[model samples]
Target: MAGERDGETLKRRGLMLVLSSPSGAGKTTISRALLQEDHNLVMSVSATTRPPRPGEIEGKDYFFVEPVDFNLMINRGELLEHAKVFNHYYGTPKGPVDAALAEGRDVLFDIDWQGTQQLAHKARADLVSVFILPPSTAALEQRLKTRAQDSAEVIASRMSKAAEEISHWSEYDYVVVNDDLERCLAEVKAILTAERVRRTRRIGLIDFVSGLRQGY
Candidate 1:
């Protein structure tokens, strides 16, 4: 939505904002905050083989599907990216994302490095990726424990995997070390604000400028 106030309005193409992080790195928290604040951004609803949990809505929370259907989608190239986690298949449906992009509505993705890599391959021009890192390993472990949603064994497993996930930091366009939640969220919002105005992303800037030249 960033634009200059020339004679005409500048239109911008939508972007795919991706946030990736190791478990307990605060990417989810940041994503949630961004969604709450940004009315123009929508979360990419993924399809999953897992059944809906309590209070979860179909199509909004996820497009609940059978494993066979998920595989069919993968085979037909209907998915932007698909991954198996904990024996459940999760993927982003290409149709909705494409529609949103064509309408100039930004799509936000809370996915891992693997999914991000797939999206980059398919739509690198529209993708703006950020990697979130915890301030320290101990802080990461502490945040995992504080959640209390996972067992000690699961927390330990996630901690073990955290190092490998952090290694992919170099793949991201921007990296934010989450020492403080508010500060990190502000940094991410700043990144999105700046990227929104990038010359290449602004779709009709050339025409707007041309119109300005004619006026002079």
Candidate 2:
């Protein structure tokens, strides 16, 4: 879609952009930067059965619900996609994402490969999934340790799981190596920009083109 302007016509359909990567591979950092720079992009808030991490906020970082409540949401069909990771339930709420898509606003998801697959099966047309990779295992481990959020044991566990997470990279539409954070962010933004204007995603394209032809 063209850049947003006041009173602009020719509305464009929005998309669901999923960014999946192993823990501490910079998906979250890239997501934060993308949201900061793109006014049209909105973050998808997931409800999780896990306790809040430091500096995490309710309704922003996550919904932070009990396991029973999370299960209830699942049984009630409130989640667009739900998955269990490390014995905790995490899910994307369906209502908010549907509302954002209806309003022609893009929803950015920082989820796992499982959630991405679920969304693809549900709404593949609106989905643009990207898998971010670390430059190397050593680099990935270093980045995880640098974040200081996890203990040695937790870091080791994450490192062990990274291989399995990365094995699903082929399922994504795009794969970016996060050797340089800024460059990776730029590449992800480029993909978003190109996808937004795809012929199928724009509404009323045939009519708009016909009107233009008549003007000649």
Candidate 3:
């Protein structure tokens, strides 16, 4: 549909922008930048069975929970999507995401391809999935190694998993090869703008246009 200036015909629905990438592909950094720049966007805090890292806040970095509690959420259908990664269960809760979308706010999900798939199936209309890839496999390995948090063995494991993760690129709606973070962030912002202005999202446009015809 064409752009309508009428107030009643330009209402927007909430959007779910899922960013999927390998462990070292920079989705976390890009997602944070997007949240900082976009006032209407909120990051979806995942519930995890893993312990919080040193400086990581409980409700901010993740909703740290026991394994049993994580399993309970999965069984209760409280999580929009849940997956086991590196021996820890991570999931996006249903309540907050639904509430945010209902309020016409966008929720940013930093998750893997598996979680993205589940979110797509659950919130098919609201989702705008994006996959991020490193500029090259060599760059990906270098990035993983530069992170001092992992040991040599762990880094190798992550590098191995990266290949499998990159294989799912075709499943997502959009793809960004993150050679330059700033340019990638700009592209992401453009995608969000376009998705928000999509015809189906502006439900009130029809009525506003109708009113305009009477005035004309």
Q: What lDDT would each prediction earn against the true structure? A: 0.92, 0.91, 0.89
lDDT (Cα) of model 2: 0.91
Candidate 2 TM-score, true structure as reference = 0.87
Candidate 2 residue 31 Cα shift, in angstroms, is 0.8
In model 3, the runs with Cα more than 4 Å from the true position are 1-9, 51-58, 66-69
Question: Which candidate tops lDDT?
Answer: 1
What is the TM-score (0 to 1) of candidate 3? 0.87
Model 1 lDDT per residue over 82-122, tens place: 99998999999999999998787899999999999999999
Better of 2 and 3 by lDDT: 2
**Candidate 3, residues 1-216: lDDT per residue as tens digits?**
344355435668889999989888899899889988899999998999999889999888899999999889988999999988779988998998899888889999888888888988888899999999899988988898887889989999988888899899999999998999999999999999999999878777677768678883
Give the best candidate by TM-score: 1
User: Which wins on lDDT, candidate 1 or candidate 3?
Assistant: 1
TM-score of each: 0.93, 0.87, 0.87
lDDT, ranked from best to worst: 1, 2, 3
Cα deviation at 52, candidate 3, in Å, is 4.7
* Model 1 spans with C-alpha error above 4 angstroms: 1-9
